[model samples]
Target chain A: MDNFSFQNPTKLIFGEGQIAKIANEIPKDKKVLVIYGGGSIKRNGVYEQISAALEGHQWSEFSGIEPNPSFHTALKAVEQIKAEGVEYLLAVGGGSVADATKFIAAAACFDGDPWSILSEGARIRAALPLAVVLTLPATGSESNPNGVMTNYETQEKLAFYGRQLFPKFAVLDPTLTYSLPAKQVANGIVDAYVHTVEQYLTYPVGADLQDRFAEGILRTLVDNGPKALSEPKNYTVRANVMLSATMALNGLIGSGVPQDWATHFIGHELTALHGLDHGQTLAVILPAVMAEKREQKHEKLLQYAKEVWNISSGTESDRIDRAIDETRAFFESLGIATRLSDYGVTEQDIPAMIAALSEHKMTALGEHGDITPEVSAAILKRCL
Target chain B: MDNFSFQNPTKLIFGEGQIAKIANEIPKDKKVLVIYGGGSIKRNGVYEQISAALEGHQWSEFSGIEPNPSFHTALKAVEQIKAEGVEYLLAVGGGSVADATKFIAAAACFDGDPWSILSEGARIRAALPLAVVLTLPATGSESNPNGVMTNYETQEKLAFYGRQLFPKFAVLDPTLTYSLPAKQVANGIVDAYVHTVEQYLTYPVGADLQDRFAEGILRTLVDNGPKALSEPKNYTVRANVMLSATMALNGLIGSGVPQDWATHFIGHELTALHGLDHGQTLAVILPAVMAEKREQKHEKLLQYAKEVWNISSGTESDRIDRAIDETRAFFESLGIATRLSDYGVTEQDIPAMIAALSEHKMTALGEHGDITPEVSAAILKRCL
Candidate 1:
């Protein structure tokens, strides 16, 4: 295995009625800003539970952070946080709100323009400490130090990272997810599965423990996804899904290995251009990316086939093909469309996407760093 | 699933030539105490690497912490640390030295008799910060908050736990184990395997991800043990074994699960009474414990059979028996004895071990809390 240093200090408070822990987790003296998206917490009783938990705390609320967590909305929250002298942030909704809260936390302490951090990918110095009441199980923003922020004017989305942005604590009560719409549940499952695949299906770097962990998360998502959709109120299904999401991108699978986030890098463009949901865009791009990089990722493809998809008794090429087919099938099983045309994208958009990728000088995409702009275009065309 | 709060803040610096990073990991201003066991590190060249790394630091060395890490030895280290005003500790040998450093770090800060903390098992208020340069791949003291310390004077062994004693960082270079004696390697393999099984083969606790992770570590140990034994110079095999040891007791496997460490507790007595190695004691005791608790641990044993040992075609009883037998065989394959008699322990030692276990009043010995003292004694007899 390649040399690596790993450390994640996020304290995970999981199980029923864990939302009440938000008050105790954050210090009593710190002024708090609770961030949410579209006020879903109000309808789901999460808002009431959080309010009751923080009965005496000096706090305020910032609502209506959008699904993709745009820079503009997060800047407004940062303004409110500065105005209120907020020392801590509590994100109470989905990954979007959690991601936005992270941005707001960093922006509150940043000296210059907050957008500069997103555009230039600046290092974060200090940030208001943040905690989360995680009602959504996608993105794993609660435990990881990564945030994907979008710019509406530029039609661009990009990721920024800093160790200081990890949540001080996250309260994940699966019971709070009982009211989630079936589409969101399916999206969460697909997002988590793709997350594991992006980390696992690159190349075998002799990281056996990480490979097994990634496969374990994928297996859990596949085994438990259908049940979660059909029985939304089932605590076991929600618990399993919640745990799977946390494990998928908590920096566990990606340690000591090369990660092919080429699918995610491409998926972000689809989300930026077509306004597709993040998870849905991944469903559209992952198989195509796998097919494009099959030669470089052959051994891992065979391992993924044998361990995850159970596609043994095949030649290397056959195993890779079957693994890619099985991946697309798994996403389809989650009711996600795996083709660009299914989302109403025309052939003309392919050129613009390729141009956008090339403008970023995005060569060396896969584990071997060979997915140049030309290869990216071919992958997108294959998706079409 | 259970309501749980999980956090591990230990920074793991892993892989080839990581010992050089030790200088940057520790604070420059703090007075440091470097602790070690015997002089094996000098022979292995780890001492020169550590001495070169400690060039600019205010550090002192305390050697001679023996196997199992007795409190008697730790007290001397504690006194020296107090006299020298040591602010931080760097444990530079195997688990024994690291475990001893944990106790010393805690005891140096406490005002009362140091042994009271071990005998009475009280919560520790504070501890000097500690880090590790792990030369051994066994006890997992590098990444965990628990440590076992023995009292040679009284012939007693006990485990003490305090979150404050968790290492701030651990440098794990698998290359450090290349020169270890064959006996040490065999003991390390058995110790790591039993650690995984202790958390796994109990009852199904709905911790699907944790179970998979535990089984993954077990499979890695089994797959890599013989190679590590035969090809001691193979970097990949040593790296895999080293990583398995860290993963085994890093609290990842016990999350949201009911863990049965009854084997470790029973095994410790055998080690204390008969002067056997910790891993050897475990190898002899675990199969007997499994046999005694087979009815209570039925479902998980069948699951272990199917997933880990691949013994699927059988009745429930047959599968459980086969799983237990396979576990014993795996330990024997590591060159460990599966019965107490194989190590020359007579019948007289059995009653003393039973008395030690009874004094601890560990009635709930298995997953269902059904292994009473009588059951434990019966299991011991089975081992004989």
Candidate 2:
């Protein structure tokens, strides 16, 4: 195990009727700005819960935060924060809304142009206190300090993180997710699964607890993701998936370990250039990354094959192949097609992806920084 | 899956040589009190690390906190805090020092007699801020708000908890345990194992991730505990066990599950009466609790049998029995005897233990409040 420091201070208010508890979490004195994506919370009854919870506090609303959480849309919310004197932020939708809220929180308090926070890696001195009413379980944004946003002008997706961005509290009422469309539910599952494996699947670090935790999350997602779609209102299934997603990227499993995020960075480029859904991009890219990096990740792949997929009866090469195939099959079973051609990406599109990787200085990726632009292009060709 | 609100705010500064970072976690303005047990830290060079970390801070020392930390000893520290106007506390030893510091932190701010804080469950409105430099990893007091303190005058051991008691931060350097005696290391392993099972080994609520996490902690301890005894300076083994011990009782596994602390409650009586170490009492009592409550915990015991002990391919009853026996053997392998008689307790001592449980109002224990005094007596008889 490697040396690490870990702390996540998000108070997770989970299970049924937890939305109401946010009333006690956010102070009555703060003027709140409730942020949401495309008014889904309004249709799903989450808006009412937020309204009721914030009844005692002075508050306003910001709707139309999009998936991928565009940098321009978040800048508008930051402007609104300054205009309305918003002291606290309440994100009321899924990862997109929460991600936007994180950016808006920091951008509102930032001294200069906020885009530089993402593009130039500007230091974040402060941020508005933020909380979340998590209606979606993907991205694990509710409990983590990470946020990814797209700059429509530059057509680039980038992540920014700081200690100040951790949410003060997160309301995760899995019941709130009952009305989600099946495609979105599948996307959530695939996103969480890839999140877990990205931190895992890199190399062995002898971090036993972290490895087991990563495996536990993967196993939970595999078992609960399908049930969540087939029986949308099954509280047990929904709760398990919701909690698993939060735990997947909440700094627990990834701590004191080397993490390979080459797939995510490549997937982000796909999302930026082609407008693929984040989860869809991950499904298209991850199996290819697994195959291309097999030699580097050989030992961990065998362990993953055994512990997660229960495939122990094969030559080492056969087991690795079976694990990757099982992973792609799992995503396909969730109605997510794994092949890039299945989504109409071709040899023609590969060059743009490679160029995007180079432009963003993502030429060297993966845990060992060995996934150069050429290697990423080869992985993309495998996806083809 | 139960409705639950969970938060643990203790910043875990983990890894080797992370002690110096505490200088940043603590405010330089506060008058600090460094608390520790009977100078194990002094002999182990942990004291030098802590002293070096607090070099610029105004700090004083309070020593002689014993195992099963006495309330009287903590009270003396509270008085010292009052006299010196100490505004912050830094517990520098293991669970005992941390537990004692918790009581002292709360008692110093209480309006009246501090004993009521333990005896009468006084409402704690405030507490002095505290942090920890954890030289011992057994009790998980570093990352959790819960603490156990013994009222030596009353011959009673009890637990107390409050939101205010959560440590501000914890410095977990696994290397700190390198010089510990084999008995203490073995005791730490048993303590952490029992902690994991107390939260688990109850009825399942479809809490797959929780179950997996509990099993992960148990597996890590089982794999790493003996190695810790033999290869005391092996960083990976020490780190895994240290991290597992902290994760065992940090309120994560027990958050949404039914927890059977009956073993712990029963163990406390044995300790309060016969003066067994906390870990020894757990080793002596847990298998008996499993035997006594086998019917109620049937499903989970089977799961535990297969997952942690890998005892499949037997009748369910056979599996449960084998699992219980394996648990006892594991403890014995650690040089901690698994029977009450092994500790010199006889049938004559059972009544005193039962009387102590009754005196502490622990007549009904375990997850479902089903372990009555009679059931506890049965468990004690099984132990004998």
Candidate 3:
């Protein structure tokens, strides 16, 4: 295992009726800015919970943080913070709202243009305290310090992370998710599954516990993700999916291990250029990446097959192939089409994706840094 | 799953040469107390690493914290802290040292007799900041807020926990374990294993992820613990064991799930009465607890048998019995005998052990609160 340092300070208030805990989590003295997306919280009763929780606090609302949240909208939230002196941020939706809130929190405290934090890797020196009433369980952004935001003008979707942005608290009431559409639920499962594989499926470094943890998350998603959609109100299934997503990318499994994020980087470009939902992009890209990088990730692929998918009675190569097949099928089973063409992107669209990868300087990616633009292009063509 | 709030804020500086990170973890201006047990760190190069890390800061040392740490010894450290106006604590040894440091950190600032914190459940209002340079991989006190401190005067070993006592950070350099005796290595393994089962092996709450995580820890320990003793210097083996031990009782698996610490509570009495090491007591009693409570824990024991022990090909009762037997064998394979007689406590000693549990009001012991004094006595007779 490689040397690593880890600290996650976000307090998770989870289960039924947990949204009320947000009242105590955020200080009443602070001027709070509650952020959400597309008014889903209003329809789902989450807005009422947040309103009830903030009864005694001075607060205002910032709506319309979109999926694959853009800096264009978040910058407006930062402007609102600057004008009103908002001291705390309450993100009341899923990953996008939480991502935007984190960005707004940092951008509000940043001296320079906030886009540079993502585009130029500028350090985050300070950030407003952020908390989340997580109505969606994908992205794991509610607890993790990382966030991905888009620059609409540049057509760039990028990630920025720092310790300062870790949420002060996250109220994860899975019961709040009962009102979510089946497509959204499926997307969450697929998103969390891909997150686990990105941290895993690279190679073994004798990090057994991490491998097991990664497998556990994958298995939980595989077993409970489908049930969450079919029986949306089953608290156990929803709780499993919710917790799996949070654990998938909370930096625990990824720590002390080599990680392959080529799929995510490529998926981000798909989101940026072609406007695919984040989970859909991952679904379309991951299996191809797995097949393209099979030799490099041979051993871990076999392990993933056996431990996660329970496919052990085959040759090593056969097992890996089956694992990739099962992975693609798993996403497909969630009603997501895995091929690029299935999403209306043909072979001709591949060059544009490769060009975007080049523009972003994501020529070399993955754990071994060998997934050059050519390799990525071949992987993308496989998705076609 | 049940409603739960969880947060662990301890920064982990892990792997080789990470001990130097402590220089930045603790403040430079604070007067620090470095605590350890029996000077093992002095021989293990941990002392040198700690001293080098503490060079820029003013620090003093307190040694002789025994195997099962006592409030008596911890009070002396607290007295020194009060006299010297120590503001920060650096625990430089194993769990005992870390546990003692936590107790001392809380007790130094505590009002009235500190024993009330354990006996009377006095609230902790303040505590000195604490950090750990963990030289051993058991008990998980380095990162967890909980600490068990024995009151030698009363022959009572009790646990105290609060948010205030969590270590600010922990430096876990697995290389430090290379010099440990084989007995200590085995003890660490057994301690971690029992910790996992205590949180697990209760009736399932459909907390599948927690069960998977618990199983992962158990499997990692079963797979790597013996190798740690055999190949003492293997970094991978040592790292896996160290990380597994820390993850075992760090509150992640126990959160939102019912935990049965009947083994631990019973094991504490054996330690307080018969003078067995904490790990040794656990090794001797856990299998017996499994057998005694097999009916109540029937479902989880079946899951444990299948997932952790891979004993799926049997009747439910047979699988559970095999699992218990395998657990006992696993502990014995570590060279820690799994019977009270192995520690020279014969059948005659059962009454005294039961009396210790009675005195502590451990009449209702497990997750179901059904491990009454009678059940405990039955469990003890089986241990004999």
Candidate 4:
């Protein structure tokens, strides 16, 4: 195992009726700004529960943070936060809302242009204390320091992180997710699954606990993701999926290990260019990346094939092939199509995706930094 | 799954050469108290490294904290802290030193007789901030708030806990354990193993993520514990076991689950009465507990048998029996005898053991409080 230091201090308030915890968690005197996406919380009764919980708090609201959490929308919240003297922010929708809240929290307190926090890498000295009522469980933005946002003007999707971005507390009541559309539920599952594999399927480091933890997350996703889709309101299924999603990217399995994020780096380009849903692009790109990066990730693929898929009694190449096929099949099992053509992405779109890698200086991707722009183009062609 | 709220704010600084982190983690303006065990640290060069790291810090030293830390010894340290005006403490040895430091930190700031903090359940409102440079990986006290201490005067061992008792930071360098005696290493392995099973081997709660994480920890222990024993200085093996031990009781697995700590509770009595090591008592008690409570833990025992021990393809009763036997054999393989007679305890000890449980009001134990004193007697009898 590689040498590492790990600490995540997010106070995860999980389970039914946990939203009321916000009443005590946020100090009574702090002025709060509640952030949400597209007003889904209004239709789903989430907003009402949060309002009931925060009955007497001095608070304001901002809505319509889109999926992919555009920077423009978050900048508006930053301005509102400054204008209203918001001391604390509560994100009450999906990862997009929570992701946007992270940016808004940093931007509101930033010294200069807010976009520099994402584009020019301004150092963040402080941020608005943030909490979340996570109505959705994807992205793990509720518990981590990383947030991804899109610059609609530049057609760029970018991510920023700071130590201050972790939520002061997050309430993950799986019951809050009961009213989500099936497509979004499926998107959450795939999003979480790919997030785990991004940190996992790289190479062997003899990090036994980290490997087992990553496998455990993957296995939980495989076993429980379908249950979540089939029985959306069942607490066990939803709780398992919700907790699994959080654990996937909450820095538990990723610590002390080499991580390959070529898939996500590529997937983000697809999302930026084609306007594909975040998870939709992951389904389209991951299998091709896995196939293209096989030699670098050989031992892990064999282990994943055996432990996760139970397919070891074959030639090594046969097992690798089977693992990649099974991965694509797992995506399809979730009603997620894995081929680029299935999403109306084509051969002509390949050059733009490869060019985006260079434009973002993400050419040297993967655990070994071997996924160059040329290799990325080949992987995308495999998606054809 | 059960409803749960979870948070652990202990910053864990892990890996080789991480002892230097204390230079930065502890503030410059505070008087510090350094705590440790019988001077194996002095012999192993750990003390030297710590001393080398604390060159300019205003710190006082307290030595001679015994294993299964004593409250009497801890009280002396508490007094030293008061006299020296120590604002911060750094525990520099194994679990005993770390555990003693937790009690000292709590007792120093308690506004009453310190024993009241333990025996009379004084609610703690504050504590001295503590940090750890862990030379032992066994009890997980470095990363958690719980600690066990013995009262040598009364021949009673007990535990105390508070949120305030958690260390501000813990430094775990596997290289520090390189010179440990093999028996101590074996004891550490068994201690960590039983700690995990105490949380895991119970009725299922449909907590998929929790279940997977528990399984992952158990699997890592089984896979790496022997490597740590056979090759004492192997960094990967040492790192894996060290990390697995920390993760075992860091509240990840036990959350949202019906945990059976009957093994630890029973083992504590045996340790208190017979003066056996914590891990030795666990090895002696756990398999017997598994056999006696096989009915309540039937499904989980079968699952443990299948997953951890790989014992399937047999009758249900046969599988359960084989699993228990395998567990005992594993302890014996580590040169730990798993029966009372092997350690020279007799039937006379059983009455004293039952009295201990009753005296402590631990008459009802296990997940559902089904392990009455009578059940405890039955489990102990199986050890005979």
Best by DockQ: 3
Where is model 2 chain A poorest over a 10-residue stretch in terms of lDDT? Answer: A40-49
Candidate 4 lDDT by residue in tens digits, B1-384? 899888888888889998987888888888999888888888888877887788788988999998778889899998888888999999988888888898999999989798887787788789999999988788888888988788989877777889998898999899999998878888888998898898888898898778778888888888877778788889989999899989988888888888888888888888777888878999999998899889989999998888778889889999999988888877777778888998899988898999988988998899889899999999999999
Better of 1 and 4 by DockQ: 4
Off by over 4 Å in 2: none
**Cα RMSD for candidates in order:** 1.6, 1.4, 1.4, 1.4
Query: On residues A163-182, what C-alpha lDDT tens digit does candidate 1 reach at each position?
Result: 89999998989999899888
Candidate 4 ranges with C-alpha deviation above 4 Å: none
Ranking by lDDT: 2, 3, 4, 1
Residue pairs with backbone overlap in model 2:
none
Residue-wise lDDT of candidate 2 within B298-336, one digit each (tens)? 999999999899899879999999999999999988889
- Angstrom error at residue A10, model 3: 0.2
Off by over 4 Å in 3: none
- Candidate 1 Cα misplacement greater than 4 A, ranges: none
Q: Which candidate number would show the highest lDDT if scored against the true structure?
A: 2
Candidate ranking under DockQ, highest first, comes to 3, 2, 4, 1
Q: Provide the lDDT at A196 for model 1.
A: 91
Model 4 whole-model lDDT (C-alpha atoms): 0.88
The number of clashing residue pairs in model 2 is 0
Clashing pairs in 4: none
User: A154-187, model 2: which lDDT tens digit per residue?
Assistant: 8767789978999999999989999999999899
